[model samples]
Target chain A: MHELAVTREIVDVAAEKAEGARVRRVVIEIGRLTPVAPDCVRFYFEICAAGTAVEGAELEIREIAGNARCRACEASLELAGPVEGCGCGSFDLEILAGRELRLMELEVY
Target chain B: MCDHCGCSTEGHEHVHEHTHEHPHEHETSRTVRIEQDILARNNRQAEWNRGWLASRRLVALNLVGSPGSGKTTVLERTLKELDGQMNAAVIEGDQATDRDAARIRATGRPVVQIATGTGCHLDARMVKGALEKLDPQPDGLVFVENVGNLVCPALFDLGEQAKVLIASVTEGEDKPAKYPHMFAAVQVVLLNKIDLLPHVSFEMDAFLGFLRQVNPRVRVIAVSGATGAGMLEWYECIRASIH
Candidate 1:
């Protein structure tokens, strides 16, 4: 849904970077907590970039793991998703990372 | 070199000095490291909204929930409570129709509606337009009732001071764990339709226990749109958050 907006951004950014050079590939990094589907983004990207500089450019997705902090002890630790408590029995937690959605690089000719 | 055309020209057009890449140079492809945030445009718009709201002393609160979670009902009631004490405005988002906006209009408050059409969630750009149309008073509250959906809405930021997620007892007890993205993003959670507790098989204690586990700092408010049982508490919580 909102991926339409994000996919538009990817095309815009990638095309701008391409600068008539002809895009070959575009690589992106998605975070676990960002809640965006890679397949959906690719589908929209093709539609939004038709006949443009990024048309048919291969898209590669990489993952970024999330990290969290304990609200009680302030200890930062790796997080897979949502959890009930920290190691010390504190239910309070703060997620610090894995929210990233960035266009990392591009292969242009 | 100009990236746009791979040509950065300096002199007058036609009569230019001979310039070319070496014949032996082979440039098949190049990898440019962009490392730019894909949502930078949205982030900028959201930041602008935040600045605009802050300069005007407007407290923007985003309400997120499932379609049948009674978000509109809760808002209709909350606007009533803030009628005189705190001036309020509403920016309602729905897939189609101005019905929500029409409902809020009856409260005699400034209200704007965004019809997303086929879109599932409200983005910052839509919020920007709604804010311009809303023109919330300097010490007022702006309620952004997001298009009802727990998942996609969580990914988009609308420059609200905080996100308030509503879940109904009819939604059962495992919603928090099932939709962790929405539940984790908010600082407050409203368990709507508490009046239905008598008839529903919802396990309130277990739900509360799981919610706390998912977000220990999250404030949970039990509300009933039909009975208006905990509307006051909701208003108080809003006051506590903004002030």
Candidate 2:
């Protein structure tokens, strides 16, 4: 899964920042529409963090909801799922959020 | 050896013996708001690959679709029809076997096969390797037939000039809605297997409506590789892109 690849990058970036410090927890922000499965990320984070500074560390994920602005109706709406068109039947909408996958913070000692 | 403030002499002695203590406190928490995109790295690689291809003046198209979407058949007919007019090379991707590559090779064009071996999609790095191996580049079309998958392959960018999503009528009219990301990211939507339309209940209006809803900018071309219907326009699009 692509989540595994993303997890590897997270682990690499966290380890680089840790700089020999023992990591206690890692917090990540994931958007709902990012195409990455949260369960898959959690499963792979364990595998990727093995033998690294973030080993056995807590993996925290905060899911962000998808938000969009309708161009036709000029209404801001939170997407329920992956539906693209607006309530006004307009596909010309701009995505605001919920496509984010970022490593937010790290707790270390 | 006893001190007035020491509770335990052994522990106090160890504490006093450690002289490398720093006065400043270390931060226990560090915040890094790395709002980096997950696909950013892959996109970078894809851009690099694109630059390399562009430097060589090669036109590459990433053909994406589900299994049995007539991708290979379309390519076969394309090569046969455009013989001597366009010099084409193929980079065939599959989970296993060189069957697609073999078929393309039979068309008398240089073909390279990248077998993923259980990987559901082809990443930019894989294509980069294929391009490196197939050097001394030709000046015409380079078709990268991605692994037969609708979902996973849609996420990966293979450094092609255009991403072409192929969906046959036999699959159903709702494919564009079901796999909107694939359709949304593609430049051209090839509706293949129109020859079987008479045998199947494929609604053209509903399909076009769904496709437009997902991506209004995507150009649609319907063709039946088996019967050679509506292939001229497809060939013209390819030729125009190459030129």
Every candidate's lDDT? 0.87, 0.85
Q: Write the per-residue lDDT of candidate 2 for residues A25-55, one digit (tens) a residue.
A: 8888888776778899999988999999999
User: Lowest summed-lDDT stretch of 10 residues in model 1 chain B?
Assistant: B9-18
Summarize candidate 1's per-residue lDDT along B1-243 as a digit string, tens digits: 644455776443455466885588756999999998998888889999999999998889999999989999999988887778888899999999999999999988889999999989998999999999888889878999999998888878899999999899999998888887788889889899999999999998889877877676788889998789988889898888678
TM-score of chain B, candidates 1 onward in order = 0.87, 0.86
How does candidate 2 fare on TM-score? 0.85
Tens-place lDDT digits, model 2, residues B77-185: 9988898897788889999999998898898988889999878888999999988877735688789999988877777777899998889999999998897767877
Clashing pairs in 1: none
Q: Please, what is the TM-score per model?
A: 0.87, 0.85
Compare the candidates by DockQ and give the number of the best one.
1
For each of the candidates, give the backbone clash count.
0, 0
Instruction: Report i-RMS for every model.
Output: 2.2, 2.7
**Model 1 TM:** 0.87
The Cα error of candidate 2 at residue A29, in Å, is 3.1
